[model samples]
Target chain A: MEHYNMNLTLKVWKQKNTNASGSFEIYQVKDISSEMSFLEMFDVLNEQLILEGKEPIAFDHDCREGICGMCSMYINGRAHGPWEKNTTCQLHMRAFKDGDTIVVEPWRSKAFPVIKDLMVNRSAFDRIIQAGGYISVNTGNAQDANALPIDKKNADDAFMAAACIGCGACVAACKNSSAMLFVSAKVSQLALLPQGQPERESRVLNMVAQMDKEAFGNCTNTYACEAECPKGISVSNIARLNREYLSASLSTEE
Target chain B: MGLTGLFLVTFLIVHAGVNACIFINDGGATFNAAAHFMSHNWVIRIMEIGLFAGLIAHILQGLLLWKQNTAARPTKYAMSAANENSKWYSRSMGILGSLLLIFLVIHISKFFVGTKVAMYADGGANDASHNLYLEMKEEFQKWWVVLIYSLGVISLFWHLLHGFQSAFQTLGINHKRYTPLIKTIGVGYTFIICLLFLLMPIAFYFGWIQ
Candidate 1:
């Protein structure tokens, strides 16, 4: 692949802390290689900032790969830049031109407030998960993996739903800042499995209550969460979540 | 919201079907007969009560949901650009629904209230002589009324375009094979239903029907 070096301008969000008023700070970096990942480019800029005795931009990132869900940059009005189904860390510099002025900010949602520059406190997700997102089993030695004899379709569906990494991109992308997709993905994964049957009724109810308590918006069925999901999580999981919630709410005997 | 939305969808079809009776060009006789039947039949009358209740519940729930959604994001983004992520109508249901609510009030007053008044004056539902078709004709003759009705139908068109498939999705009827079919049916349904409703006033104003 052919590579080119480009000088670019970045307008990044800067704040001392969550309570501080924030603003965009523009920094020009010369000779940015097109082959570098988006975060690598940020690394180059940070190195320059530190050498000049300035505080570098603070952004959340663990794996340079897309799996960790730690990276949460909203670039140029998108959750993860211009590419579809691409994470911020996975976004390459090639997507931008030499003279591009990229504006980078943190995920904007009430449930995921900014902690610092381009880093939001996503612990609400952990709370939502803690509410129900687990299965209870009796204490025993490990059973054979094939003992369950799960249906192939159900297994595949569960696998797909399980792929959610708890990224807040779905909330960032939604007009209402809804977390339905993330909650639904978790709900659907458990709902499809036989192991998740014991607490099935209470599980959905508890998780959804937690989600509501966190002040995340209701799903408007816009499907934006699915579109921006780096894991390509389907909105059908949300449909499943709705199904679960409605059934749990309506059932009197359970 | 999903349950009531589906109910309203069914109601729209029956309502549109009755309105399509205007296209028969029978000088409003067929339309009046259908309207009278709808008002007089016990089952239909009972369903009408349910329909009204459903509509009220739907509206109240929608408002509450909108309030919660708005409060969820206390702070707005400096640069949203939300249209890049979702359809305009999907994000604007509150506005579209409010428009429809205004239209509904005008519509029910013109026909439903008139029918009730005539029924009471005649001392029974069997003897009520109000001609709703005539009221529609007179109303459509006013350009502003027709314009308002047109705008309402336009809003209905956009609302149905988003609501139909969304209702199904919320109900968990989504499937790889059936989803595309549902979406196609949704598109066709929206166009046909809105066009049928739109034709009523246009036909009255243009003298296509008596």
Candidate 2:
């Protein structure tokens, strides 16, 4: 594809820390290549700020290819960008044109507090995972791929659910700030497999309890999370999550 | 909320069906008899208690859920393109539900109270004395009353449009084959129920039906 260069304006949110209030700060960047990823554009802007003896803007990123789930940016009112099933780092600047003005902000959720300019502490997700997003079985060695027979449909669905990168996009996109999509994807990833069967009940129950404890909003099934997810995570996983949660709650001896 | 909401959904069918009796155009005879039977039957009376309980539960649960959902976002976004992702009615259930609650209060006061008062005055026996059909005609003759009723039905239409499928999804009843089906049925249900309800007010107001 042919690449072109463009100049653009950016309006970015700046916060000193978790306790500090944030505001939009505008800046102009020149000769930005359309081939550059959205984060690279930010890098150019940050370099400009440094040259001007100004503080560089801070944002999150790790595996720039999009698998790490570390990058989280609400660009132009979208969790990642305007692109469907795209992450912030993977969002090409080609989506915009010359003289475009892009606005960026960190994910806003009560459960994910702002740590600095464009990074929010996502340890709440870590805490939720700790709550029971794992299996108890201690398999000392790798098993043969064919050792456990799995249904083709369940395997496909499980693979799809496992594609979720645990990005905060679901929470960011939700009107209620709900993490149900992320939680449900995680739940469905395991719930469909025999390996996940043993801990399935406890996993859903504990994780949901921890999720509720995290001050995340409840799911109203508005389904914005599915629409905005970079992985294109399906909302049907949320149905499975609800099913697992309800079944577990019902049969629990406690 | 889903369970209670579906209960109310069923009640809407019964409500719209009974009210549609007015279309019989038999000088209120068929309509008042059905209304009288609904009010005076003992089994129906007990079911009415359950209906009220379910409605109150749905309302209270909805309010509490709305409160928690609101508190989830302590800081609002400076810019939101939420409409890019979801429909407005799905996200605005709280406001729609509040509007519906206001309409419901007006409805109960206008027809329910009058019908009950007329019954109690007539020794709580099965009586055609209340002339509820005439009352509806006269009450709807007021342009404001018809306007409010129209607005209520419209609000109810939107609520059901999202809610019918939503209740099933909440109950963990979603399926690839069935979710689409439920959505189609939900739209059809909304239109039919709301039209059935809207027909009465517009018909009475315009004197299209006796």
Q: A51 in model 2: Cα distance from truth in Å?
A: 0.8
Q: What is the DockQ of candidate 2?
A: 0.84
| Top candidate (DockQ) | 2
lDDT of each: 0.90, 0.92
Best by lDDT: 2
Candidate 1 docking classification? medium
lDDT score for residue A69 of model 2: 88
What's the C-alpha lDDT at position A180 in model 2?
A: 95
Provide the global lDDT of candidate 1 against the true structure.
Answer: 0.90
Lowest-lDDT window of 10 residues in candidate 1 chain B? B121-130
> Second chain only: TM-score per model?
0.96, 0.97
Give the least accurate 10-residue stretch of model 1 chain A, judged by summed lDDT: A245-254
lDDT of 2: 0.92
- For all candidates in order, state the fraction of native interface contacts they contain: 0.64, 0.76
Residue-level error in angstroms, candidate 2, position A187: 1.0
CA RMSD (A), model 1: 2.3
